[model samples]
Target: MTGLGDSRHVVVVGASLAGTRTAQNLRALGHTGPITLIGAEAELPYDRPPLSKDLLVSDWSDETVEGFRLATSAELDDLNLDLRLGVAATALDPDTRQVTLADGASVDYDVLVIATGAAARPSPWRPASGLLQLRTLSDARAIAARLALREPVVVVGGGFIGTEIAAAAIKLGCPVTVVDPVAEPMTRIVGPEVAGSLVDLHRANGAATRFGVGVVDIRGEAGALTVVLDDGSELTASTAIVGIGSVPGTAWLEGSGLTLDNGVVTDARLRAIGVDDIYAIGDVARWPHPGLGAHRAEHWTNSSDQARFVAAAIAQDAVLEYSSTDYVWSDQYDWKVHTVGWRDPQGSSVLVGDLAADGRVAVVHADADGNACGAVTINWVRALNQARRLLMAGDTAEAIAEQLEQLTVRAA
Candidate 1:
């Protein structure tokens, strides 16, 4: 074992949010170890959520683009990092603790953090042309170019990404239609108490929706395409953007001997199962969560939180097990959607405020014993803040709803 000290070298795969934050946190925690950050994309690490929320709609300037960067060139140099961008880790040899890069080069490390993250699921309905997916800055730029054409667009998913893009297209004066296989695609996500309201939000904002049908096939080229649905219906569009989901970037680790399930399975301490000195974090790492059992979170907060946790454990020799409530936020059209903790379908849900009447809503979920477990708030930051505070303190659904109602009245 190469001991855990400032003298050891730490290699991080994937220079996105999780990986970059891991290195930053290590440095902040006073670990002067030699750190090598490997990234597949040539671009410096940047924020991703804005790609769907703002980049597609705004007339961004050079300074605005620079703002997206996690750190500037000078800032990175100050960290004294061996930043290896435009190259990806090809293979890993755990026995030797060496990572081989794509350019026929290998780097050794005493500590390794598998923050490689997940990639967008490839579109299955391949047309002659004009298909898009958002996973990288380059991908966002390509989609922005297509969206600039001001032609009709079909977003083939009803999730957060798809809806955000749809909202952006609508703002761009493009005819937009969102298609999803599930009747209420958000039911499984935001829950039944408020899913329909969110779907109606898009309709109210001038975007057509074709729910309860799956895309069977797509044909034609860019600016003129046909989308065939499973329900024997067809829709024509100039472009189609698939925001289905993402898969862990574990293909390169095929024979690496890591217990790969949906992601790199990690124990309670966020350490890769059955391995010493190697840890996994972010979307690519499935850690044993205290609240939800073995779980993998794809939210931005989850990745950032896990990075800090893992870095503390490594740099400061922290012994606490990793724990966090699931949190996700999205900017869809004119409303801000914020969800904290998990949404339990089996648990009781209390709804406060009406979306149609007031354009704001909050849903608090309570466990079997009437303890607040999770919450979703839309266009109501105060209520969201209170819910998060009360949830952490284990408040009851009734009490949460009453306080939210009081807040609603005061705001009114």
Candidate 2:
């Protein structure tokens, strides 16, 4: 198979985890062609997961945070990539194979990879000072500085990031409250059983909850913000962190003739629908999964997995249908929550151990047909690994549950 060869120039947008990994993989695969990496932020690519995790809770210096850099200056130089930083892609012209930058300059490419990733969904309530959202390193630094003050904090969402931020704030001895409209905010991701345990864990760690409520308005200045609830109640806090969700960064491809429904719609091979020589990955691409059907994965593992797959595909290597085990994890207090595959709350769930007593439990979920769909385990790394292997091996949910039950009983 003849790869693009050393002649074709590949342009990758978004110098993020997905983008950086893709560029590095391309070089590793012996693609000696000209590779250009573009990023909107001025800083080099860094890990985003730590932005809400260790960066917010610990008093780590900027150098320590730089340890999370995906690629150092030396490594990037070794890759021989034309690194373009602090410039945003304003528009994409598929017909001309050109990408216009924010500086009114355009770059032509033989092949284009859209790994633009996603942006933090802005909160409707914007206070001049205390309101914050964590997406970039800058945002995390601001939140960490505010958390150091140990003032009262109100988190306006109860999703994974919101809950994680709340946990970090609680560690700082700040009175924290998590507000969400849904009863169990993350039930759709980790299923009802595990999400319920998470809520309890937060409460046990001195974090307050305002579940089943929505934010009506945010009033006051930065130092003191009043959060008004839909139920006509109010809570005052020194700072507010919004972790609602994120939207794809595909606005530049608006008139590029590519299908954009929530994200750039791609086929099973990660190729953009209706466009040749263009591929999409990471949070910006909604591709078809064999089990889950069509969906966009926002997890860190998904981004890296897609990057490796796309890199291999571009190098004319053995291309396999993109199939991910779909793993995601969260850290709340001392508990480590891990999940694999898909978890459906409406489906049958088999619980192996007691979440309250053992502090370790695994919930195996099955579809209506009784086939294994996913599993969620709390502080049970062995059980989680076992479930992942069995799920990938086509084991039935009932069969996996029986094995998990035996393991839990033996551990007891």
Candidate 3:
């Protein structure tokens, strides 16, 4: 791997976690090149995980929010990034290697890294004032204020964000109801076996569930909202938080000539397809995975991992193939759920421990070929670690479960 030289100017669009990390990694990897990090928001990059968990349930304060900052002022200065804040990239001209900003300014670069990430999908059923979606810091602040009211809350979509928001609402003593269009909304990600336990956990915590139903309409104003379900039932709540999912923030790249599926299509090396010296990372990159095929990972760890890999690739350091272990965790009530690799709901899953008795369970999933593809564990960190190691080694699902069981027994 050869370096891009000290004089090469690299422009990073999107001053997100991925964007900030990329700049830091480039400097750390001995790249003396000029680097510019641009973001649409005026504030510095902050950690988003707490937005769904701690930020929502806790008392609202600017100081409390500042605690989630990814880097302090001194750390940002050490990174030495040419920070462009409060402006967004309006367009991209890959041919000219220039990015057009909203302020009628264009930044030319020898290398470009797109880390625009993703935005929360807006709910089709929009009410006057109570409808909300959590993506940015402002959104979290608004939701936190609403939760502090201790009013009835309806959260649409039972995905990770939706569930976590429900958990937060529960903590605030709010009457919360989570609605999803599937019998088990997170089954595709955590498998039906483990997902069932999650559903039960939420139910036990006093969060009502309305699965297999969709939101047809939202009526009324801020303090009084009626959420009409597909089954002709109406749920009355003071506020509604829609956490359906996220879509790639690739609208600005409409005519950028780069291939865009769900995101900017990239090779295994994180380089944009058919584009020279252009890369995409984080939620905005749909990269090829060796085992999972083409996939876009929206997890926080994925963004950081991709940023580190792309930085090394750009700096011409050790060129290693990018392969993600695909890790994600969720904190719901007292349970800490963790998953590794990919879980297919339709795939065969073998349970290793009792989920009902101890809330410590591991579900090892296997593909059609009987190869361990993924695993989900609840309050069982050791089992999850063991499954990850075995899965990476291409162990069979049976073998992984057997080993996990033995480890559990030995510990007992």
lDDT of each: 0.89, 0.89, 0.89
User: What's each prediction's TM-score?
Assistant: 0.97, 0.97, 0.97
Determine which window of 10 residues in candidate 2 has minimal summed lDDT. Answer: 1-10
**Candidate 1 lDDT, tens digit per residue, 1-412?**
2224567888999999999999999898888789999999999999899999877777777787788888898888988999999999999999999999999999999999999999999998888899889999888888888888999999999999999999999998999999999988888778888888888889999999999999999899898899999989999999999999999989889999999999999998888899978999999998877556688899999999999998888788888888786889999888899998887677889999988898889999886666688899989888999999998877788988898999988987
RMSD of each: 1.7, 1.3, 1.4
Ten consecutive residues with minimal summed lDDT in candidate 3? 1-10
Off by over 4 Å in 2: 4-6
What would the per-residue lDDT of candidate 3 be over residues 6-94, giving only the tens digit for each residue? 66888999988999999989988878878999999998899889999988876667788778888877998987888998999999998
Judged by TM-score relative to the true structure, which candidate is superior, 1 or 2? Answer: 2
In candidate 3, stretches whose alpha carbon ends up further than 4 angstroms from where it belongs are none
Which parts of model 1 have CA positions greater than 4 angstroms off?
A: 1-5, 368-370
Cα lDDT tens digits, model 2, 133-249, are 989999998998899899999999898899989989988889999999998888888888778878888888998899999999987877789999999999999999998899999
- Candidate ranking under lDDT, highest first, comes to 3, 1, 2
Q: Once model 2 is optimally superposed onto the true structure by TM-score, how far is the C-alpha of residue 246 displaced, in angstroms?
A: 0.6
The clash numbers for all candidates, in the given order, read 0, 1, 0
